[model samples]
Target: MAGGSFRKSLGYALAGLAYTLRTQPNMRFHFGAALVVVAVALLLGVGVRDLLIILFAIALVVIAEMFNTAVETVVDLYTAKYHPLARVAKDVAAGAVLLAALNSVVVGLLVFYPYLHAFVRFWARSWRGGN
Candidate 1:
């Protein structure tokens, strides 16, 4: 095999995605979180531009997570036993994911905070008998 055709490459990419979803707990969690974020944005009727930003933020986190998983897997393959450089590599990859996650949180807050506040206020008013 001199390499795969485009369709085969796409299938292989999907297989890699499935493998990550299956084997990586954090990947699963990130995907779940992304789903929730998208759902909330839809419910809140986010503007198109904000929706795009939210999508970008979610993608960044997921992409970072995938990259981090790749780095960890390659590092482990390189060495079974503990190694300082492997630890460093894993830690740095994890840090990249952390940064992405944090950035997503910031974007979410920027986009959703006012809507969340309005939601809370509406609920509060309803609970207080429209006072």
Candidate 2:
């Protein structure tokens, strides 16, 4: 890394990201979820602040997942046997992903609840023949 060209470093980073996307199902799922969330937010006309918060939450979850994958890969590389420490390392990494995912869910609910609530109310009124 030291003395490496900036472009070369960027290329390496991009290659790692591509490898992760190609190999990790969880990463793919996160990307798909992110796309859906962003599309919905746009359709709902979410305010800029809330949209930024949503994006941050999405990034946090994806970054945590990537870190978890890295930790698992390193642990597996270091030990093939079932060691207690390896188990602990993997579990801790997984817990990070879970926490990030939970945070994203909370953020999503907070940001989207108002829009969805109004939409549902309008839908109900229409169904009941109310203005």
Candidate 3:
């Protein structure tokens, strides 16, 4: 029973991912940004802790965008015409995504800035040493 339930949950999660990929432009952008972050972290030789932080931030932004998309879709389904409260609901959902994306940006900068700085400094020192 537990095994069956786990499989069902996994299937549902995959379906949700598929839906987002099919319908959401923002999801695509977030996914592309996530790939860039991962590549940057790898190039910078970020440690395990930094990688975890980066992953968490990426996940946070993606999840928030997914939730925002869901809310907007539901609102549109319920109302064919313009309504102030429906607009407010959609706006609030978008705001949530914006806030989460901002937080992710802060997290990425905080976690990676030192590594980036050190990389630049190392290159500068090596160039000077070579000269």
Highest TM-score scorer: 3
Model 2 global lDDT (CA atoms, 0 to 1): 0.94
Q: Write the per-residue lDDT of candidate 3 for residues 6-117, one digit (tens) a residue.
A: 9999999999988997899999999999999999999999999889988998898888888888899899999989999999999998998899899989999899999999
Off by over 4 Å in 2: 1-4
Higher-scoring candidate on lDDT, 1 or 2: 2
* The candidate that achieves the highest lDDT relative to the unseen native structure: 2
Clashing pairs in 3: none
The TM-score between candidate 3 and the true structure equals: 0.92
lDDT of each: 0.93, 0.94, 0.91
Residue-level lDDT tens digits of model 1 in 62-113: 8888889899999989999999999999999999999999999999999999
Task: Report how far off residue 5 is in candidate 1 (Å).
Answer: 1.5
TM for candidate 1 is 0.88
Instruction: Count clashes in each candidate, considering only residues at least 3 apart in sequence or on different chains.
Output: 0, 0, 0
For model 3, the local distance difference test gives 0.91
TM per candidate: 0.88, 0.91, 0.92
